[model samples]
Target: MIPIGMIDALPFGNSRRVRNANKFTELKASIAIRGVIQSVLLRPAADRFEIIAGYGRWLACLELGLTEIPALIKPLSDEEALEHQMEENLNREDLNIIDECKAVQQLSAFYNGDRQAIADRLAWTMKKVNERIEILKCCDEVLEAVTNGTITVGHAMILAPFSTKLQQGTLSKILTEKWTVSYLRERASKGQQNLALAKFDTAACNTCPHNSAAQSGLFGLEDQKAACSQPNCFKEKTASWLEIRKAELTEQYGTVLLIQQIDESDRNTVDSLVVGEEQFSVGCQACEKRVVLIDDRLGRALGSTYENQCIDNLCFSKCVSALTSPTPIIENEELLVAALENELGNTTPTISTETAPLKAKKAKTEVSCVVPKKVIETNKAMLRQTSVDLLMPQECFQLAMTYAALKRLTSNYKSINKELSNPNRFEDTFKAALRLNVSDLKAEIQNITLHLASIESDQTINITNMMIDNITFAADAKAVAVAKWIPTKEILSEYTIGSLSALCIKAGVDKAMDSKKEGGFSTASSAGKGKFVDAILAAEFDWSGFAPDEYIALIK
Candidate 1:
């Protein structure tokens, strides 16, 4: 037995950060009734002893005010100490998976990332080592949640492959919505696109661990069926392949039509072009209307395409009408010519080359000076205010509106208001020695009062005009302010998928996403927009001049 005071815990001794309160209480009770039954493992350390195992038992003994603990003191290296600590923690019924991950990570580092060696040392299967190490990819919040028993290790594993911010957001949803492990498992499995239908090369996916075929060894699968675990990667490669195919089609056929870009009513397939008695047109191959199409099947077939379709149904209908219509002929050419000239004279006059440029320039000048009826009405209303004696009331209103708009538009308004709360004050020590006569002073005061009312009237006019116009210079200025606006998942959730995709594409977020990972581009483009937003927030990227048109339209 060694004195409890003389024994110290090694750094890796406490594997669990959060312990079950009931379990700890029961342990203390067990020790109090039976005293120390099992001897703790320890090693000699500079006149004292360092605990190799049984740190929890040592803690229970100390809390009970016990002076001595039964222990077997032996000299062990750091590796042996860590192994013993892990063994003791693993034996406990209430060990947190996060603590297990931390212990495994330490052991991994000890062997310099030799997975096989670490697995052998811990007497665990290679698959188990791979699974535990993958759990480390989860964000801090997820790991903490697992440690706190808010979520199971299965949930953590499902969320581990995604980005950190996504993991955090998904964890919150899992708890609040009480998402079942089965639902997550189903979602994880069903979200994958079939490898057999993929337009891209399947060579790389054959060896990828994210591929179902590559996981047969780890998962102990009887069959080596192929499927993709990383939907983003699959989507990205498929999109790239589709683009390459589009480029080739564009070279062969002058025009390539995207089926999604055409309206349902305007699109026609080659098979549909064959009328009851009419045969399929062979000339279509060489005609100008010979267009190749790529169809996405309304997002059902995300990275797949359908070839050889026409978007111009109206043109085909016109050709058919021309072929079926009867022709009319005119016998008197001079009479027809005279009739045409008279009609042209009454409706559309021909302008000489020299006069055309002058007419166009005059028309442009007239158009530029013609103010919108809305702006004119606002100006006229402000002009009717006779009480205010100020020049250019409209310009003054514009200046005041601009300043007010800038403050509200920019997020710095609150900080600027804080600065205004405390202003430097100075006393006017020197007063004017000469005072104006009573009549002059009264005239001056009246003039000042009139100017103040003019400013007030300008403000009132601006407020009314803003509602009528619904658009102003302020909206464009707001775009500049919005450039500095950082987007959160909540903020992004307010936008539709189409709107978010538009904003991300315009901002070159797809390219940025691709730069980070191999299949990131297509995955972010087609999958949830939240991943793009999360990546932007994580990198603290300077998305300068990035403003959603809808956001600007709100003010307009």
Candidate 2:
């Protein structure tokens, strides 16, 4: 091995030339800053040195303007040098994929007679070597893409299953359209047969109400949930036709008829008028129950429009009016007489001389109206009876009375001038009267107080157990003190006494020792302090020492 002057261009082989010039530039920058971390391997030839490995470094050194470089000089046969060169280039991180594929292919050819021998020498699977050989069969475009780093070998492998023309088409699509390899694979898996087929027509989508609603942004999957829970549930569309009908009626009619009004007599009539299949129906057996109904058939029809589909009662009523009205007939005789003279040429030609002119048959009546008073009265009675039945139970009523009395007394006290009123005197008198006259209320209050006390005692026990488990005697005394002071409420459920002690041990209590570092006296600070005080009381009563790490962990 010797350090020699750098050669302008080392002749290894024309086939093994650099593909990416930027890679050499990066190497030059790295060499300038940190010098060469590795030395090039070379073999002595008949007249000069031949590079066995480290072509990238050789180029980088050339770019860096280094006149000479350190080299590992090794004597080897042509076959051995070539094998070492392939291994070295294969190991380089920045080796271009095309160059690697080419090198692997040549190595396999050179060592054809020795398959296992080559595999062991290269430290690669026979299967992998075979796959690299197959990669060489890919068309020039695909190979060029692989060389330029536009597509990965994995992507190439997916494309490998397709015909060369198909691969080229897919590659072109990917490059032009920026399709991801996964998306390509997904499309391919769907089969190439469908790729040429026309996509579904947008106009065809108008046939589906859901598609229309989605396009218009009027309804979505979220609104669908609300529709399901509504009184009218329709399958083909999300919104109930009943809701649309109500909105329509509200907009068009001066007033919408009460559900009771429709249910009592004309719900069937309205359903027959609204042009759709009935989805939901409700009827009240007593006092004319108001019922909400949906027509799913109409919903499907209007939903297809992708816009407002309101068709209210008012519109239906108008249609009914048009159908029932009679055409006008003229009753004036002057016009009739003129038309008769004009047609008959002033003829009063034939006068009927029968005994007495028969009177024209009387016209039949064409309109009728009806009203029901008994039904209205019955409905009012039912409503009043239901209201009375909903009163509170006897015990709840008694409790309410006691609460009212207490509230009244409190209100009267509040109204008094504080400067003139003796609150202590008022409280004492009130307490005495409450105890004497409200014995049951007093007992209830005592029970509540006892229950709260029990809960507090249990919480205190839990906090004491945590401090004992977390604190260690070897920790800093101040940190121990701080850990003890941390409130039980502040500790997360996962932080047992042992864990808190470990945390205090990690965090020294130097801050706790400084008076200036104490948190301020705001409501939040007070609550925190209260928690710390509770923890401290628990620790002190249990004779637990603080672990600095445990305390610090808690703080963090």
lDDT (0 to 1) per candidate:
0.55, 0.42
lDDT of 1 by residue, 380-419 (tens): 3332221122212434333333333332323212212222
Cα lDDT tens digits for candidate 2, 400-480 = 234333433332232122222332333233233332334455554344333442312111123222223222212352443
| Residue 525 displacement in candidate 2 (angstroms) | 99
Candidate 2 — which residues are off by over 4 angstroms?
A: 1-23, 33-37, 113-117, 147-149, 161-164, 178-556
lDDT minimum window of 10 residues, candidate 2: 279-288
> Which is the leading candidate under TM-score?
1
Give the C-alpha lDDT of model 2: 0.42
Q: Candidate 2 versus the native: TM-score? A: 0.31
